[model samples]
Target: MTGESLVYVAWAAQQMNARRDEFIAGLVLVTRSEIRSLDHDSRMVDLLNASITENVVAAIHFLEHGGVEADVEAPTAALVYARALAQRDVALSALIRAYRIGHGRFVDEAMALLAAQAPPEKALPAARELVHRAASWIDTICDRVGITYEQERDRWVSSRSGLRQHWVNELLSGSAVDIVKAEDALDYRLDRNHVAAIMWAEDTVATRDVGDLFDGARSALGEALAASGPSLMVPTDEREARLWWPADRIDCAGVQAALAEREVSVRIAVGDVGYGVDGFRRSLREAERVKVVALSGGPASGRVTCYEIVAPIALMAADVGDLRLFVQRTLGALASDDERSESLRDTLREFLARNGSFSATAKAMFLHRNTIQYRVAQAMDACGVSFDDPDAIASVQIALTACRWMGSSVLRQTNPTP
Candidate 1:
């Protein structure tokens, strides 16, 4: 390419770099057939077109980040661009070649030919020349970059998957329901709680080990997970993202070192040791939250920071025996206010003691089944448990345990506050 052509291509690349959607739309129109079919005004069509545009977007981003150096191997990007601007026949073959050497020029020529539709007889020879040119261009680029096409392809795939999983995993297993819903509406399938984190260069991670991502510290991470733990990495999208392994003894020293950088300045949270996925979820949430709210104030990443926010609830769950006693005694003293709560507790115990059959419990209390249910609901409601959730089961059970230990206090008709 002459200096004039080079300057034009460079300027064109800049335009591509800055206005990705428009550049990619132009790319899609490089060939005659695609040019004829795209609906300029349809979001659905734009979305359909995004599959190709996405690759261009990434390439443009990398180019912008790397500067205008031709030496920067825009590997794995041509195929995306080529496939998106499917102007010629053998699109798939063309895609495959874009990863290899010598194919880059062929792509440029093919795209040029695609832009100019000649009669079939002439088009055939021109297309072949274009392919040859592209293949040669790709070869030169590969040699310049010193990376095999296969290696680039692998890295590209891995990087895209890693980024996607990062987003999905963040939405899943998080308290961000609205975010999750919005993403799901966009057809991003994300099962809850299936993700992990990896340790990359501290604070300087422009992109992940596998991807060219934006600047936000990735919520989905992947790293060399310790083999002895629950699992530090899980398949966020089959490329492997780091997940919280509850049973694993956290490498605090290693983690601290990994996060020791002064820039990103975030903290990691590890969860209780035995609870498997639950613990992982809790710890991951805690760590992520701290990184968001507390990290701004300054705390290092990759270490345990209990987040103290959930301490009371956690402590109560850890040893509800004592908590239950306290709750029961407090309620027993306040019996004057709601005698039905105490009565319900006593009745439920006797009913349960006789066996879990609702009829038996109702019979022992000489109450209707519906009445018994109401009191049970009332008693559960009266307890600190949020009966609407799964967590309440244990809370209510603990309260019962405490009330049962009350000896005569339970049945004394002690004139619990009215």
Candidate 2:
């Protein structure tokens, strides 16, 4: 570029700098209109406006006095805006789009100023130089700011997740805490009804990206549960994510339907509806207990385990060793791990559960009434239990349930099934 063209660029920069506010306002208006993602709320808008002003001023300054590409740095406001976007979980692509849009408008305004200030011949050359320099500045600034956004996003999420985990652990530990402080730190209300769930990916499918998998699961769960605003999602490990919804109750059927549609192999253990702080803690505790029982049966047993359905087994699971002895004593030979004994135990359990009704047990187990009666007799002979004693029947019933869930863990067999 000739000195005359440089002089023309300087004149154009001066003109832009004089009306910097108007120029920035126009640029912000156009960028916000074109890029909807950048317009989140009033605070975000303020950040965008400040970012635009800083970027515009830097570009004009560079136009007026040529500088090495390496010497140019992204303005503080731009970096702050990028970090803000990252903290909000907004994509970096949106930030870059805002810059590109503003760059074009900036160049157009500078070119118009140059054309009016310089002679016709000098205007063309000056405009060319202006566009080149503007492009270089944008490339440099975008690279720097993009890096900043990613770094900030990782750091912010890690810190935020860690803080949330800390608070959750404190709450779960049953320690005395200031309710207001806990709510502020967690950004979750403990005064509302809560339905908690523990989710984990199957080992086979867990090799995929952990963050993406959990994030997708969170969205799916939220939609299925009809959760409003932000729900508390804290990942306790790489494969497991624990979340709570401010809901009176969870729609288990809805969750099943959603998971079926996605076809994502995941197991979720949900707790019953609880209210206030006590409910929050109790719900999570129940979910955790449910998860332990659900995973004990293997990955393919059940996809969604509700605390309500498994409440008794979950409570008994607190002391597996004690429960095992109780099962052995109550059921005797009926708790054998062998195939025949296992079948009889299952039949007898159902028979007893249906109020000692042979037809009802047969219908439920899809077997003949005679078969149900025969199995019950054999099971009774092995265990030597009597129906005449109501307390004995209740104890037998509980043991059978423990056998059904705890499987070989509570069964009386030398080599139990895995």
Candidate 3:
């Protein structure tokens, strides 16, 4: 019976096209008029007329009398009632039933249509995947740079951790510091976005007052920068230590002055807020630069000065030591008006010390590599440091480093740094 019902629906669709509009319209609206009574009076005994439209009427009649077919896509149960709407009812009830039956498949069809409209929907994701790509491009560049990518990564990590360690060790000294797990003891909300200052007082200040400084610093740090965590004081021997400040939330000068009352006079080298790890080097380099300021008055200085202000003067200090000798010995021919001769010697020495690696030497002096190369060749022509000779490069490297203690050059052999 189910198979018979399904076969009838296909027969109905095929036969409907042949039916006359007038005949179909009348059949569809049967409830409005007594079509069956009219047909009976007309003696429509043989409904299977050979005329195409008449055969269609027969098919419609047969469907209306309960003959039907299953919808492959629509629900099987709807087929029973589908014949009731077979004559195109005003309610459009049969179409509505078919829509419900096909609802799930229609949604899948819509998505497929959308996908067809767009081609190759992947660019950013492909770029992101490249992050895991094993290509050696970056590694090659770094190898030529005299530093490995991994080594650079480690250096960056160490600089940041070192800065944190410097503060943690001092702030958490003795019982106050939880050494079992140094990192956990720190209520630290820091990694990147931190800056620091190295503050020192004259040894002349009373030791109790110096202790008062630590107490005062903590109290001040709390009030001034509520957003930042507490300050960490890293002890560097007995003479000095470092203080950590979250740059975004704290003021370096205010903290420095607060310590001045108890410590009497302190030197502070303000460090920059470094990128999580890599940028920390900026802070460390600046801190090291400002140490010259601390050394200006032997760590007892009162003035709060920026390293940039004193960098040029500090650089000239070494020259001042061996300056006349450089002018006399290294630059002896300068009186003959060869201005570049001595300058070129300094350049050559820098190049050789860098192991012929233009990039490394350029970094040490903060110069460009091409400039360093040019200066090296200039220096060789002026002075006599050859690139091919390791012994010559060694001599030059030593000489460049020993520029600080120029007159004591002979003494350097007794205590060589390398």
Q: Each prediction's Cα RMSD?
A: 21.3, 21.1, 35.1
How many residue pairs clash in all the candidates, one count each?
A: 36, 0, 5
Per-residue alpha-carbon lDDT of candidate 2 for residues 357-395, written as tens digits (9 for 90 to 100): 999999999999999989999999998888898899889
Instruction: Give the range where candidate 3 is weakest over 10 consecutive residues by summed lDDT.
Output: 40-49
Ranking by TM-score: 2, 3, 1
Alpha carbon lDDT at 383, candidate 3: 39
Cα lDDT, all candidates: 0.40, 0.82, 0.41
Rank order (by lDDT, best first)? 2, 3, 1
Show model 1 residue runs off by greater than 4 Å.
Answer: 1-122, 139-264, 267-418
Model 2 scores a TM of 0.58
Q: Given candidate 3, what's the lDDT at residue 337?
A: 24
Q: lDDT winner between 1 and 2, please give it.
A: 2
| Model 2 residue 234 CA deviation in Å | 0.3
lDDT of 1 by residue, 1-418 (tens): 2333333333334554555555455555442233433322122244335544544454444333433334444445443333232311122443333233112422453345343544554544544543443344445543533333344444533564434444545444555546555344424322333222332222433323433221122321112124332333332221113344322444445444434432343224433333433444555554444333222222221233334432333334333345545555444432322455558777655654665567888887788888877776665555544435645555444445444432232223445347
Model 1 clash tally, residue pairs: 36
Off by over 4 Å in 2: 1-158, 176-178, 223-229, 251-254, 414-418
